[model samples]
Target: MRRIATAVAAALALGLLLPWAMPATAASAPPAAAAFRQEVPRTILALVDLREEDTIRLSRIHTMVELPLNHLGLSVVYWNVADGLPDLSRYPGLRGVVTWFAGEPFADAAAYIDWVGRAMDRGVRFAVLGQPGVRLERGGRPVPLALANRFFARFGLRDDDGFSDLTYRSKPALADGTIGFERTLSGVLPGYPLFRKTDARVSSHLVMRRADDPASDSHLVVTGPAGGLAAEGYDRYFDAEYNRRQWIVDPFAFFRNAFATDDLPKPDVTTLSGRRIYFSHIDGDGWRNVTEVTPHAAKRVLSADMVRIAAIEPFPDLPVTVAPIVGDLDPTWNGTPQSVEAAKTLFALPQVEPASHTWTHPFQWIFFKDYSRQKEAPFLDRDGTYRPTKSDDHAAETAGEVSDIGRYAVPRAYLQQPFDLDQEIGGALDYFTRLAPAGKRAVLVQWSGDTSPFEDALAAVRKTGGVNMNGGDARFDADFPSITGLPPVGLPVGTERQIYAAGSNENTYTDLWTNRFYGYRNLVNTMRHAGAPIRLKPFNVYYHMYSGQKAASLNALVSVLTAARATELAPVAASIYARIAEGFYTARFEPLEGGRRWRVRDRGALNTLRFDRASATAVDFTRSTGVLGQRHSQGSLYVALDPAVAEPVVALAEIDRADRDPPAPVPYLVEGRWAFSALAGEGTGEGAGFRVAATGYGEGAMVWRVPRPGPWTITAERDGAVLWTGSATADDDGRLALTVPLSGIDPLILRLRPILRPSGGAAG
Candidate 1:
């Protein structure tokens, strides 16, 4: 995210000299020319200090030049000189260097010129980017401006007064009549060939006046015929001096050029291949109205050629898990079950996945606001009197809200919350972990208000289990609906807000009311660029749920989802459950002759059972020696017997008291034999079926059944010695019935022997 602006500039200037000095074996360079024929290599490397300037626009330029520079095979490097230059030796192939010196109070022109000249003399090219009259310095002392001015005048074509005639005009006319401003081009130098055929369009206005003399053309670089360079349009000529202001240039163009040129070796483009990009909604409280609109607008802007849409999910702890479009379920709402149900019915469709946006989107508490004085205070009072509290109290209150939500919503597992510091994150995690069910994992959604906060929150989220951050251009504001249900009364065109409104109507289920839009297309494209999988959750944009009953809003939601799918932004692919099942069957399970074995080779102890089997029980072979018997009070464990072989089985009863040491064993009588059979050919292929049945058991026990049948092996062997072994076979019907004696062992295991045979052969 950080741009090496100064390095880029210097690299561009010095890149011109690389080919001549290349070694004989260099691939891109021709044989070195004769000494005199060899160009002096006046590489004018320049580094632009963007720390105090419009960094966003500067970065755009960086992206732009990256491709073209590589295409041209020009040597170039753009360093963000604020952090100081890197070791020049690393780039031995580069003949010259340019650096953009950055700091407070600006560098003196004289000192900068001397430094550049010295660098040039040592086979390095250098240029400084700053205001025209700015001074350069070394070791905190002023350097003479005369020397720098003199050197720059040659390349810049400036007059004695230190000004160039170069000027820019707008290619596309603005709505207003004003064509362009006659300003001296400062900051980023535009002479580099990298900008010649850039996609980013930049036009210039006529030059107005010269720096040295008002009437003379000495200081002008490229004066327009009608308007000449003048002080009126110049940035430096203003009454209030702008010291750290930077000239807006195409950064994308700059980097595109830097990379294509021979100056700086091209980076490995493949590094970014197959990487996935994930974008979530982070503006919890702010821009609630625009949330829905934001996603739609993002999809619209990014749904162009060369862009692939990645999967987009809502922040965690909501109602859904990676639906095509997800919406944020704000836990802050104090609505009851009926209210929540009503909201879900109206706002959420079956396809949507609802993610939690923390307990009450606690912006105020996280931002350190006083909430105790309010009647509906987040924190509780000592004597039931609601008084205000700070950090810890607020965190506890938030955690309570999470617990309250879990009582009703069984599917809500992801938690999208805001936290400022490490302690806050730790507190939220601790609270959520306790509140979540035993099998669930917690995911954190970071709420970053600005760049700095976003970076900070990102660092914290990475440390957690399932934390992800969102990215887009939507500005955060609290008053707007989470997603624009309907356009406001009077909104201007061409504004970002209006764009959201226009795109918000694309989906038509619930109105784009939540202000949380998926930017479905954009999310996908970024994800594809990042080489991430295309598994996306529905965009879960939420609001008060009962804010409006307008038909427009409902239609907006439907339209958004429908449009997203239509444009391939949201594909109808396999669900997470389906994919997990596929993985198990295709990768995990192995096919055997008669019946397949459901052996778990995964490193994790826990895994979801995909296919439902008929009569087998998954036994933990690592713990017990013999097959576990079924008990009347609790779920039973046992070895399955082939119903074809076993019949008239009696139920074995084992009684154990909670407080008492043990209970006497009672044998239950078999009522009557019920015939359970399977065809010899049925459920018995390479990957086929099996069944088991227990017909003669007593009436009190719950019916025991196996979900599926596969060869299972249970052994209790130590040091190459077998302690005990028992065998149970699943028939073609996939049924196994067996009864274990409950007399001697309080906890006993009867080993189930693994059967080895062809698809339809003998069993062991």
Candidate 2:
């Protein structure tokens, strides 16, 4: 601890530490000490046991509860119950606590109960799934009925010393409109009945009935202001053989009603500029592999070069973040001069955002948590090279730990030297930044191999001022067939968080890139599903540089990009998407005017907020501050906020009705292809106009809903140089359309001046 403090002090004195970076002391302690202050209470604490197979990543709660809560735009903070409950008071805007335990009870049942009671005392609601903590007891003896009932009473449930009716043949029945949604309820329900009766305040969503006894009906699911309970098998049904989960209880309705999340001001990351966000990122794998494609194959061109020539150069309208593996680009490793030159060329592109894929790609990141040179020595090949050998495969087959070893035969893709976290994270980031042009440093770090770096590794990436992304491998299509396949926005990695790539790469689609190379063409299906019905994720085109090795894989990538270009989307850098995801976890909201207005703060780079089922509402410009404009899509109103504003107040008002007088004209943004910031609107007379800084790709398509009907001259300028000037007339409803051709990614200043006539009418 003393050494850490000294190092931190030295770093602070030398100006080497970023303000947002996690210090060594903070990383060792509960992250809440640093996070809770700025973050809003939009997080649900999910409790699980690391000793059990059911963890936060692969538990019933992840597949059932987490997915639904994500749809409600909520973030999850996972806590291992064995670690004891964190100080809930330290965490602000904590919506509630959730628990789902299986098999034997927790090690200390009494302590668990006491912690839950303490949380309840603080007005933090608890949602129990499968086994309730109060019901769990040490040894064979049961918890006292008085103590158990006290916990149940909080949920409006009254225990009558009854537990499980094993012989009773019963089935679950959905209560009218409750319970069954998406997946229908079927088969006999498992019995471990707890409560016989409930208070009048309880709402029973699902009930169980006995086949023979008419009076033997028990509450399978119940909820109230205090929280809810779904007993045993009624919560979810997991098919162990297929590794799939089907919900017997509707997760959306359950979480919404249980947590009261219906009207919360959700910080949405999916939409921007009134359209779905589009972003692309490429992994640095296969950068040196020779292309097998036509034309490029004749010259023995590297896959990375071919990808730059074909996929990247053609797409000037889209921004793609290129993350190069430091081992592939640095000459000290196996990298050649050609590889280094390719990386320098790629990072110089105007549309490309430079990033790092790590120094040595660790295949099984968990193995390095307690790294041991002796333990890893056995896995290295006898030839001195760290590549996989026949012996390693035989050992893996005999050990039956294929999942533990990950995709590679060894623990890490590069193991020539001892594992060093600093070299793999910070060193790689610095190496990539040096390869980029001036003013364009490495903005993100893409996790390689297993993509599950430990807490310290994640903190190291944060310390370097880089956003960590990759992992989750989110996919939803006919093959995966369920929302359960879609992971949450990101994972809670102890003191740090890892932002996940929005969609899976070509490897998953092509069965590890062995066959069906064209399988990635079907990515369009996952992209479409992720958006429609409900916007669960943004449009992310994630792939490897190796896609250029085969014509089919490269074509599939081009096809997806073409489809993305045709769609109405607000294209942003991969770093922007990472920051937006970070915003979802850290953004704070203060609801005012009975939920009609919200003061959003500490949102990071997330510049858009969405209100679902708000077709009748519009941004009240007069009341709203720091608002750029508004756009409506799929029955949801997306309000664009100016990132320059420290705290933006979004006020929603009813749309002007026929019965009411038409509102005075104010030049307000309707929609734009470019991203806007530092927006300021002024004057309602002849000089009535607005000025905004815009940055984007392709031709800038924009429209403004003006305050009055008249001819308007729009001039776009950059550094006092007028790029273009055009005149257009506002329609009767007051919408003036304009276009500004964008040739670069830099922000341009746009000023609109109303061209008035003597008669205050249309002019030629």
The list of candidate 2 runs beyond 4 A from truth reads 1-40, 107-118, 144-147, 159-178, 192-197, 211-214, 372-376, 379-405, 591-595, 654-665, 682-684, 727-729, 762-764
Instruction: Report the error of model 2 at residue 606, Å.
Output: 1.1
lDDT against the true structure, each candidate: 0.26, 0.73
How do the residues 160-267 of candidate 2 rate in per-residue lDDT, one tens digit apiece? 665555634666543645566545565544655646656787789876666645456677788888888888877777778987766767776788778877667778
Model 1 C-alpha lDDT per residue in residues 99-118, reported as the tens digit of each score: 33334434455544454455
Question: Candidate 2 — which pairs collide?
Answer: 41-93, 41-94, 665-707, 666-707
Q: What is the lDDT of residue 196 in candidate 1?
A: 14
Q: Local error of candidate 1 at 528, Å?
A: 17
Question: Using TM-score as the measure, which candidate wins?
Answer: 2
lDDT, candidate 2, equals: 0.73
